[model samples]
Target: MSESKKILVPLLIALIIVSAFVSGCVDESSTSQSIQPQEEAVTEAETVTETTTEDVTEKETITVTDSLGRVVEVPKNPESVICSGAGGTRYLTYLQAQDKIVALDSTEDKVSVGKAYAIANSYFEGYPTFGQSGSENLEVIVSLDPQPEVIFTMYTTNGYDPDELQDKTGIPVIALKEGDMVQNREDMYQILRIMGEVMGKEDRAEEVISFMDATIADLNERTEDVSDAQKITCYAGGVGSAGSYDLMSTDSYYPPLYFINAKNVAYDPAAPKVAKVSKESILIWAPEVIFIELRPSQFEGENYAPYQLENDVSLNQLSAVQNEKVYGMLPYKFYSHNPDTALVDSYYTGTILYPDEFEDIVLEDKAAEIYGFLVCEGDVEKGMSVYETMLTISSTPVFTSLEFD
Candidate 1:
């Protein structure tokens, strides 16, 4: 965060009157920088809203530089918008601005209830599908009713260029970075602030940030005193990436392990964060415990890593497998990181690795607490209900010990 960026952000106030845009004097004022709307017009049959982005205007919009350093002008309190990436909607959920989302991206519409955020807010499925993550359907977008006032995209570099997308759709496009929960905390925090400014949820964004810092501190506080000799040697397998992977696919620097101070057997200071290792490597490392990423897709076939864990004779020889310490991890990546679930997994990991220190904690209640704050807007009953639904959907008790046939 440079001083210059801070200067641009303070100008993003929430008090801008949205009704001013309705009177029609500012017809071409949807975005500053004078970008024109797409030339391809939808026919009358497809025109849900006769007035497109070309007609949608705000009496006032503040200029804020996005994660990519593109200066975008968005309504101070945009009530109608489309979050343009799979994970972009996650931030809005944290901010309690789901009501602001007028339409869904392809992933949100198609894979409804697949992630913790989505499960907690299943009503999003009722919204019209706007576009896919990265690329959007410009025709459908420009024609939408309660027309989108701004476009917030998380994966800016994934597909359509933010500037080009704005130029084509005639809507302001705010690019956001999908920063990781670990290591990239600042990037993630910056995004929250940017969104908070746009949606007038500044205080809520800070609340989310404070919760993350305090929660991580509490996690470290619990196990920081554990000596190296007492640490549990662990490995996380079947780590999901671009495609399906078996047991050999893993991350040495898995974030949840760091939260609980689990010593990873595959950890190497110089190793790539993610890698595919040989079965022989696993035999030699012989981690005392192993965690596999649990996903609905993995349950579909015998070819996935979870299946390999049970069928592989050499793998069964490992101490962890013999001791029945193999566990299925709750879903971590849904399109991208769910900070809520990441914290939930961290607490669960602490309980498993340092049970005495985490003795007072109940995993289900902890998960509910996190979900309640992040998605359910402090509704514990709703959060707990969502958590129960997540568990049933996992096909097994993924957050706990597992049985393999």
Candidate 2:
């Protein structure tokens, strides 16, 4: 009786195990089907995240607004570029963008812009030479070796439209004007960034822009306290129709003016862009300080007074003349109009106007700083020696202009 009972128990246990195995197999299939959609969703989410990360790494595009306020899209990295103005050359050099230049105009011919020309000669050796204003020999521009991808023009009163120029040359003409350059430094940085994009030198452009930002900040900190009371009115530009009394027109480049917070006697805020005063008018204003930008002829002219003092009673009566404040701002390099030049000119003028404010800076060191800043290899010390010698030879009442003419 006991053996039969054991066999029945074992048979019942085996039947129950077979039934559980069949149910578990069905459950496993249903669970896998449910998990497949979840897995698919996870895969889709991963794909979307990867796409978004890629977009984030892409570079930003730039849009430049021309003088007319038209927004134009430019290349993210232009391999070839052309600058049509002397001012533009300074910006390119400051941006370390000489490599991007495919062509440059002949604006460097004038002594006023010779430093830029010298830079081009030193750094941009075999590039094409586009003519200036009338010099942009249309034929030469059309024949550039590799052909330019873009052409840019600096701010100017009159110039050919870049778009039209591009249409004729099959290159995009991008205008980078400087009318708003002095108001905010952001404008300068933006232009440099845009140029970097066009020239494929964004990194160098940013570095240069940063350097300018820091330099300007340091300069402002040093010169912020300079007041109008301490400033000396500076007269720039070549003496106009008048001899020794002529001054630059109000609209001309007014360097060292706002830097020292000085009153510019020649400055007529209301003067039309073309308004120019005669020598008699300049004498009427008689600025406390006078600076002369002499041309070769003017520098050598018999009538020029940098060489003679006392006997020129006409000059002796002048306020600046009576005080020995008249200084012939010898052309340092080019016209002294770059960012460094502008600041240096302000420092030099500030010294002349208020010697106490810059007592620490001697004139010789100041001249050397300017030359070094401009990357001029010319011996600034020797140059200053020449200037000093010239001034001594010309400053006496007996010193008469030796006219070769």
Candidate 3:
């Protein structure tokens, strides 16, 4: 019962209460601190997920097949492209997609592609030409100006890498398989379809393909079931070369030859490389019909020369020689494997193979009709002159009586 003692007891009790409140606040703060680490971990995991998504997006890729049988994967749509295949560069001209082409090969350099060549040469006069020396040089290809975004090589010929080329130069490699020179229009259309997809000119590509399809359909209707008896066996080649020197086989775009039921003197193997025949082999095969691919140099213009005919033998011994079934095709204009010329050659082969079936289908008149499709007006008079020149040496003089005009 002293007043001072009572006051001390109450003060001690108040201090204990304050201590308990402070301890409770500290425990609650510790719980909040425990939750903070979990929130930080969640945030870090979200950031990692976003980064992974970005990486995947950056690594997105696409693959395309080339003229050869190889498949190539590239970054999205390529801007600049280099074509290294037989008639590969012609696609640009066919589609009017020259702006996409950054470089071209030698055949294109020689202006071998007719109007397409002229147009591209005029447009890309300053661009480097790579395929001129019969082969490709990797160094020169790597040194191209404004380095190409994609390098497209032929499946059979162009020697380049898909992944390696990309790793070295950061450019994708595309394989554009070159169809057989004598391929049918359906095959050519498939090729065009692939080309259109690569060049981003699908509409134009389809248009050309449809036109070719119509042309081939018409040719088929005209020459279906040509007589086996009428089907002539043709032998062709350069004058001096003894190796394979015939026109294209089943692998080439000259399907019209097959359509007309004609047989080439050269036996087509399971896998054929060239469409030629040799002299020694020619002697053995001795075709029923002879077709010499007469060039401007070999056969002088309008005059089928007085050249030696195998040991100066009389023309009566050979079947074709006796019957004067020998003829000459225009080696210059009709020799190419381009879309335009291929169709012309197809029609030409059909007519030659089954003249009876195609009796109404005059060569010069058909040539003129095909001229519109070929994007060039072939000279009918020039064709007759070539035919006459081929028949000049014949003892029988078969071409002399035929009315070419």
Candidate 4:
């Protein structure tokens, strides 16, 4: 073969090999590009499915039985809530779950001025009001921007039903019976537990109950050995519902008197729990010691019961008034019974009734300790001024005589 022929054959073979390699590379690249888009589409679809499933799970509802024995469906985690009736907001505040409160009753604004729970949580003053007790503004509640998920209220005497309220508002209404904290302590504890569950503060609720248990135990330990005859005969005055004070307003089942084992002259099992007695009865009881409920308006000189007791001629002849056994105590029934304040009042009562037994307890220091636990976030000094302003040595003169002007 000639040189030219040899070169042309080799060139032709070389060209064929190059063209085949290029075609194989193009086919592989096309296959890889087609597979990539399919893989990406599968991955995106999986992500969307997972997100939808998670949202559905979060919206799931759980069934719970309220204080009234009604089984209702409530959100797994309630984000917003409305408190109605007496002591409704107080229970929430005790749990430190005030952040969940979407709206408050009008009474909260007035009571929050000097009250321990109210004074500690002044932010609640700005939230919208949902009307007063026995009258809740359903329209305003529904119009709330985020809308509340649950409603907590006390059982009323006028036949207000939780089931009916729930139906009307399309929100879960849990009715709790505000039983006497001293007589029906378990009921109060159950109420706290239920509220804690609703507000996601179960641990905090347990803490409150434990504190109450510890307080009662401590009081009993100090007074257990004292004889019944040694117990001071006492009468509590100026006690009423929703901050209303009557000269004869009193409760037979008052917890402070009960817990401290003091002999309550007004206690009669047959009589109503709370009633306004005749002035003649006050003379008849003639208690050795008289505890007058201090009012916020005493400074304003309007409807001050302590001053009324001081000036009343009929009460002057009594041993309590004659011997200066009359003392001022924090109003136990402002809006509703304040368990924390009531506990503190018991210590004060115990200290006065039996000075020797409670000698180690400084009333102010004890009050500060309780305030720290319940209202001051464990800071003993932080809400002490509010407590201090409630009573003073001149006001609550147990051993000393008050030289009134």
Best by TM-score: 4
Higher-scoring candidate on TM-score, 1 or 3: 1
- Per-residue lDDT of candidate 3, residues 206-308 (tens digit): 7776766677677777766555565557654332122222332113213434434357666464434344333456567777766544333333322232232
User: Local distance difference test, per candidate?
Assistant: 0.80, 0.55, 0.53, 0.78
Show model 1 residue runs off by greater than 4 Å.
Answer: 1-58, 297-299
What's model 2's TM-score? 0.62
Estimated TM-score for each candidate: 0.83, 0.62, 0.59, 0.84
Better of 2 and 3 by TM-score: 2
- Residue 184 lDDT, candidate 2, scale 0-100: 45
Candidate 3's error at 220, in angstroms?
2.9
Per-residue C-alpha lDDT of model 2 across residues 1-405, encoded as one tens digit per residue: 699998999899999999999999999999999999999999999999999988886444457665446566666666567778655666666555556677767655443322422432454554457888524667777788666656777655565666666667776666765532245456556767766666666787776666555644544555678665755565543432322322333333354554455566766555542235565666677777666533344344444444333344554566776666565543322332355545555666666666665678675566454444333323566434432332332222111212210
If both were scored by lDDT, which would come out higher, candidate 1 or candidate 4? 1
Q: Per-residue alpha-carbon lDDT of model 1 for 103-131, expressed as tens digits?
A: 88877765544477788888887888866
Clashing pairs in 1: none
- Report the Cα lDDT for candidate 3: 0.53
User: Highest lDDT: which candidate?
Assistant: 1
